[model samples]
Target: MQGYKKETELLTKLLLEILPILKAQYNLEEYQSKDFRTGDIACMKSLLSRLKHLKTSKFFSTASSDEDLKLKLKVDAYEKTAKNDQKVIAILKNKEKGLEQRIRELEKANKEAVALKKSMERKDEKLREVMRYNTVLKAKLEC
Candidate 1:
């Protein structure tokens, strides 16, 4: 979960940078005031479709190849973060399994404690009866 959180954070930061470019493209399409043609809706739609796909992708998908070395470095960071996230998830899952096993063991011990308590109560009752019988026998002997 923590890994997922970190991945989400990093993706958010990347999106923050990409959003303005996407917005510029959207406005350009809406106004059609640039080199882009009229039937650019297909292109825009394709871009949006890609965006949707990238939303789920862990490798940080993008619509353009205009990425420079710096952006590529960020992409690489995203890649490393994703790999670390997988490792964290694996570790957490193992820890969860261990915790579940420990809980089961504790539950078994608790059940055993309850059974022991019940047996001890029964033994206490029998002990009281024996003491009472011994007391009466002693009185009779004194008489």
Candidate 2:
């Protein structure tokens, strides 16, 4: 995009320098003096068409011959690529942050589950001790 603007400005500058010569060569001075009639419209249209052709020719010729234009185009492409790379890096950083948060959450849940298992095992041991004492009491009562 930047390259295009530079090229446009250069073409416009070049055309401004060349327009007078072309106008004189084409004898448009006489047409300019004509009154604003139907003839003026037709004459202006012809001049406009000629100007378009000149602009196209000059633009293509300059684009082919200008080293500065080619260099600007390359620089613009490099800047665009750099910008895209930065964007991709930013997105990857965001994903990395999300994955790290998920890993932390999973670690917390695992710790809680381990603590609960330990508590359940202690309860089960106490229940087994109570059952053994009840059997001893029943045996003495029967004797």
Candidate 3:
């Protein structure tokens, strides 16, 4: 009777440990709906294939080890940081493009301003010449 009791206790402990892992592995929240589309079926198949691969992978075997778990956590952290860095890079590229466009617009405006200033200078010179001619004509008339 004591032997049977010990076996039952061991079995109970094993089940307690295994049940949560199974629940996590087979989480079906996404597939709870009755309405199944073709895409959903394809996605389910893909997920099953990945699960099978994961079960056979070395990562799964090492998951129970403390050192491997710590390494996995570090890898996850680095991956998150990499994603944030990529987002920042994308934002900076957009800002650079905007600044470049603004520079081009300013350059065009500068060109137009220079051309207008040259035209005004030519008009001023022509006005001075006309005034001098008028003065000469007035002096001759007086003579």
- State the displacement of the C-alpha of residue 126, model 1, in Å, after optimal TM-score superposition: 0.9
Question: After TM-score superposition, what is the CA distance of residue 34 in candidate 2 from its true location, in Å?
Answer: 53
TM-score of every candidate: 0.52, 0.50, 0.54
lDDT minimum window of 10 residues, candidate 1:
30-39
Instruction: List RMSD in Å for every model shown.
Output: 15.0, 15.7, 10.4
* Model 3 lDDT at residue 131: 99
Off by more than 4 A, model 1: 1-66
Query: How does each model score on lDDT?
Result: 0.62, 0.62, 0.62
Query: Roughly what TM-score does model 1 have, to 2 decimal places?
Result: 0.52
The TM-score that candidate 3 achieves is: 0.54
**What TM-score, to 2 decimals, does candidate 2 have?**
0.50
> Per-residue alpha-carbon lDDT of model 3 for 1-143, expressed as tens digits?
89965654553443333333433444634432221222244544554465557656665556765445445545655676789899999999999999999999999999999999999999999999999999999999999
List runs of model 2 lying over 4 Å from the truth. 1-66
**How do the residues 85-106 of candidate 2 rate in per-residue lDDT, one tens digit apiece?**
9999999999999999999999
